[model samples]
Target: MKKRRFWTRKQWCSGILLAFFLAAQTFVLSGCGNDPAATSQEESDNLVIATSFYPMYIMVLNVTQDIPGVEAVNVTGTVTGCLHDYQLTTNDLKKIHKAQILVVNGAHMESFLDQVIAQQPELKIVDASEGIELIEDNHHEKNAHIWVSISLAMEQVQNIADQLAATDPNNAQGYQSNAQNYIRKLEELKSEMHAQLDSLEDRNIVTFHEAFPYFAQEFGLNIVATVEREPGSEPVAAELKETIDIIRQSGVRAIFVEPQYSTKAAETIATETGAQVYTLDPAVTGPEEPEAYIEIMNRNLQVLLEALGS
Candidate 1:
C-alpha cells in the first residue's frame, strides 16, 4: 500500500513525449502495440458486483442471473468459511478495485470491510443484513449468520434484491422477479423444515461452533452448548469440560459440526458424552447448482432430524 511518487517537471515532460511516441507507434504497428487489456476495459459491461464470500455470491447470483452484461464475481483467494477476523490478500484488493459495487452478509461478519473501503473509497456497498434482525445472546452480542435460517435468509435476499434494483434501475424488474421466485422456494423449504422437525421428541443438541443459534431458533431446537465457542479456535480444557457437562446434564443427543471447519473438537465431546456428531451445512461454501441453498438446507434438516429426533 505504498504511494507512488509525484512526477517532477522534467519527468512529466519526458513521459508526455514518450506517450506521443507510443501513439505514433500504435498507428504504425497496425494497432498491435495498443494494450489489449486497456481495450477490454473500455469494452467492459455496465455493472460489476463483487461478493464477499460464497453465500453472498450465490444469493446475488439469483438476482443477477438474467441480466445480460452484468457480472457477479466472488472475491477470489482463500476465503474459507466466514470472514470473521479474516485477512485480505493481494488478489482480493485487485478484485475490489475492479468491482463497482460489493454485496455482503454484513453484520460485522466481514471484519476487513473497513480496509476494503479504505482501498476503494468510491465503491458502493450493499449490506444484506442492514435492516434485518440479528439473533442476539441474552447479553446482547449479535450472531450475524442470518443465512443459516431460511426465514432470515429470505429477508436477506429480499434486501439484496431491493438494493440491486435501486442501484440498477434498468434491470429492476428482473431483480424483483428473481428474488420472488427464490423466496417462494425458501418458503417451501421452511414448510418442509416444520413438518420434519416439529414432531421430534428430544430437540436438545450441541454445536461445533456458535453458528446455529438462529438456525436452532428457526427449527425450535434447543442448543445446550457449543463445543467450540468460536470459529477456527478450539475451546480451552475448562470450556470443553463445561460443554461436556452441559451435554450430559441436558441429555443432548447430537453435536452439529459445519463442513468448512474441523470436527475434532466436536468428535472429542461426542466421545465423552456418548452423543453423535453430525455434519451440517452452514452454507458458507459455494453451491454448485442454482437451487443449492434449498438443497443444502434440506440436507441439514435431514441430518438434524436423524440426530435429534429421539
Candidate 2:
C-alpha cells in the first residue's frame, strides 16, 4: 500500500529508523544475547530465515543451503519487481509470523520493515547493509542499492555470513567458509568487468533513476543524469528537461532502463538526445534456480560491456 500521500520521504525514513531502534531495544530486553541455549534451540531443522526481498533471499539461501538445520525464505515471495513501492499483505505477515529471523537490505530499502517489527518485536534481524558505506544523493538519502556493486555486494554477503555465524554458532565455520567462497567468485566477476570495460571510450550513462551510483562509482563510469526524480513516478517536466539537457551537454551515448519500471522517461530523454536506451536488470527478483544473483549481475555486465563497445 502507498504511504500516506501527505508524508514526506524524510518522515517515512525517520519512522522506519525509529521502529528499527525500538525493535532492537526490545530484542535486547528479551535477552537474545549470549544465550547459547536459546540460539542453539532456534537453529533447528526448520531454522526459518525470512528475507525482506529477492536480493536478501538469494544471499541468505546461499549461506544456509548446505546447513541442514537452516532454511531461507522470502517474507514476500517471488517479488517480480523492486520493493520500493511494495506494501505488506496479510500473507506477508503470516510468513513473518513463522520466521525466526528477518534479513533486511537495511539502508531504508524495506519501507514496510516497521510493520514487521510491530508485529514481531522479538524477531531477530540481520541487516546486510551493516557497516557498508552507502552512496547518498544531494538530498542525503542513502542510495539503498548496495548490491549493484560487486565490491559492495561482497561486503553485504560477508555481513550476512557474520550474522548467521553469530546466531548459529554450531554452523559458524560452515557459514564463514561458504561466504569466503562466494566472495571469491564475486571477485572473479568484478575482475571480468574491469577487464572487459577497462578501455572503453564511452563510459558515461544515464539511468532511469539513481539505482547505479555505487555501481558506476565501483566501475569507474560517469552517470550523466537520471531521467526520473523518483522511480515509478511520472517525471516532473522540469526535472525531465533538466536531465535531457544534461544528457545533451554530456554527449552521453546510452540511457539505461531497469526492468522494474517503465522506460517512457528514458525513451523521452533518448529521443531528445539521440541516445540509445538499453535495459539493465537490477537483480531485484529472479527465477527459483540457484546463483540467481550472479547470473543477473553477469547479464547486466554484458549489457554494459556491449554498450561501452568493449
Candidate 3:
C-alpha cells in the first residue's frame, strides 16, 4: 500500500512569530529576542536534529555541531526545493527515530511534520516557531512560509537555540554561544541589507509569490503586487487581468520570480508590461551552492537596486 500523506492540521500552528510561523508551511524560520536563555538541565543520547529546510538546519548545525555527541543533519537536500511537496521514506523515518532532538521550524510549514511526530512522540520535538505572532493566510487560516525577513529569521534562531539547550543541558553553553555568534552575524547582515535598501530610488516591484514581505518591510520596498494569488496557486484569468492593470498603473520596475517555480507567468507579465523579470532563489538549497540564502539575498538587493535604478 502507498504511504499516507503526513501533513496534519495540529502540527501547523506552532512558532514564535508571524514571519516564522507563516512560512511555517514553507522553509526558513526567523526571529529576534533578548530573553535570558530558557534552557533546562536535561540529558539526552546523540543530539540528532532533523530540519525541514536549509535555514532551520543551519541554525541547528551552528549551535550543536561543535560539541561532542551532537549531530545535526539537514534532510532538505542540496537543491532549491520546498518541504510542502517533500515525501519521507523509510530511511527518513529511521533517522527521525535516532534523533534525540527533532528541530523543526513549525507545523504549518511542513504538514508532513504531523506524521513524523505521531510515529515518534517521545522524540524531544522543538518547534522553533514558538512565541512569534502568525500572519494569517488570506485563503487558509494558517500561514506557513515565515522566514523571508532577516528580522524574523533572527528571532526564530534565538528561540531554536534556547529550546535546544534547554532540551539538552549538556550542550547549553555551546548552544548559547552559537546563538550569540549567529545573532551578531544576522544583525550585521540586516544592517547591510537595510543600507542597500535605503539607497533605492524606487521601492515598487512585483514578484511571482508573496514570499518577500519581511525583506520588503525591512527595505521599505513597495510590493505593488504578486503574480500568484496565494502561496502555491496559479493566477486566475481575472486575477491576471487585475495584476496587469496594477503593474501598468503602479509603474512597477521589475518582477521577481523564484527559481523553484516556473517563470512563464512572469515572462507573460514582463512581455506585456515591459518590466524586467529578475530571478531570486529563497535559499532552500544549502550553502553547498554559492547562491545560498545570504548570497542570493545580497544579489537580490543588487538586482533590485539596479532594476529600480537606485
Name model 2 segments beyond 4 Å from true: 1-45
Per-model TM values vs. the true structure: 0.84, 0.83, 0.78
Q: Is candidate 1 or candidate 3 better by TM-score?
A: 1
Tens-digit lDDT string for candidate 3 (223-282):
889998654667878888888899999989799888777788888888889889987556
Candidate 1 lDDT, tens digit per residue, 1-310? 9777799789999798657544533332342313334334432333668888878888888877766646687884335676677887888876776676799888888877787687667677988997887778877888888888888889989999999888666667888999999899889999989998899989887877778888888988888888777789989999989999998898888888888888898888889989898998888875545687888888888898788766
> How do the residues 115-217 of candidate 2 rate in per-residue lDDT, one tens digit apiece?
7687687688999999988887898888898888889988999999999888767677878898888889889999988988778888889887777888889
Candidate 3, residue 300: lDDT: 74
1 versus 3: better lDDT goes to:
1
Residue 239's lDDT in candidate 1? 93
Model 2 TM-score on a 0 to 1 scale: 0.83
Which lDDT value does model 3 have at 76? Answer: 50
Report the error of model 1 at residue 105, Å.
Answer: 1.0
Clashes of each: 0, 1, 36
Candidates, ranked, TM-score: 1, 2, 3
Cα lDDT listed for each candidate: 0.79, 0.80, 0.68
